[model samples]
Target: MFFLKDLPTRQMLQTYHERYPGMNAEAVAEALRLLRRGSLLMRALEAYFTAHTLSQTRFLVLIVIDREPGQEGLLASAIADRLDISRPVVTETVKALVQAGLLGSVPAPGDGRAKRLTLTLAGRAVLADLLPGYFALIADFMAREGDGTA
Candidate 1:
């Protein structure tokens, strides 16, 4: 079976030239490279997360809550804002983490309706366990890129 990365750049340029006529081959090649790299990184992350029984969003939420200072934790809205994602998405992710016992929520001191999220012991432990490997993988990738082998 043919793979995207297996396709030669010259062949890609020729195919794009045939299809789009005036399309810029250099721009198309760069975009294809970026897309392939993104796909590889995402698949790697997905596999890692799946092995740990964690979703990327849930892991991100846990990290956000864990990084918050003091014992009060953070609001779901705050997480949404920090992650630049929608409130509903944060809410759903928080719900899943809470259900999994990885997160705890309490009513905000001044606001009865607002809940502040905090990482549970399990959450902290999981993050601590996974972070070393995650950091190592990133470091390795960076090193490879630095050596022009990526």
Candidate 2:
């Protein structure tokens, strides 16, 4: 007795099962749910970053530099690798952050072709101000989900 709202997904699940007898409908449903939840969280975070005049990419770059050990800036390539982002995107974001006075860069020691990036005072301040609220949002979301209220 499938409800009307469940008919479409149930049909899709049946179709998948027919095409691939080993398909696990439950796993597929769970994966889809996880993706949807991730999308929603990203959208919310994007809006929050926008309010601070920052893009998610830029925020990510800032945090990477901020978390660097000993506050020693990291090369652009290192940032890209650590964040699993493309080099071009990291380069562009770094350039923007530098222009905004949220990041500072210097030539990497013994690497004439490489530049190291570090978070500026302003960047640290911005992250410090926003992190508490960001963490609280995550905690609240987790609590609601745990209680089946989200």
Candidate 3:
């Protein structure tokens, strides 16, 4: 219930300390440390994606497209649902990717009203170039700090 960053983390959580005397504040301290670590890691990933001509949202769109049926791709509505983002946001991302020559949109093979997205040669190359680093970051983080190995 604490803001968690209201106090310099080296400072003990007074609420936890005072609410239950003799109970060590180690739990609160550990939680704070984990939160800070997760936050910084997310920031680092965001920066890496941004600097490399990719955004996580759009990258996710690409991933969905690759994973979906036909490797042919899905409609914006399907992508929005799969990514748990807004339809409008998905639309914009698809447009940008299409413009960047990373994605191509065409009439859905079965549905005239919907557009199917497919990655182009350049898109595949971009994904190939970016995936190794992204996987490395995840692997390194989990290897070093993740608690659940099972």
For each candidate in turn, the TM-score is 0.78, 0.85, 0.74
Q: Which portions of model 2 show Cα errors greater than 4 Å?
A: 1-8, 145-150
| Clash list (residue pairs), candidate 2 | none
Candidate 1, 1-150: lDDT as tens digits: 113764346786888799989898877666666666666666677678889999777888888877777878998888988897888888888888899999998888898879988989998999999999778876766665453223
Candidate 3 has a TM-score of 0.74
Model 2, span 3-62: residue lDDT tens: 132223768888989999999987777666666666666777788889879978888888
Per-prediction CA RMSD (Å) = 3.6, 4.8, 4.5
- Candidate number of the best lDDT: 2
- Residue 130 in candidate 2, Cα distance off native in Å: 1.2
Total backbone collisions for each predicted model:
0, 0, 0
Q: Which ten residues in a row have the lowest lDDT in candidate 1?
A: 141-150
- Strongest candidate by TM-score: 2
Query: Which pairs clash in the backbone of model 3?
Result: none
* Model 1 segments more than 4 A misplaced: 1-8, 14-22, 140-150
Instruction: Sort the predicted structures by TM-score, highest score first.
Output: 2, 1, 3
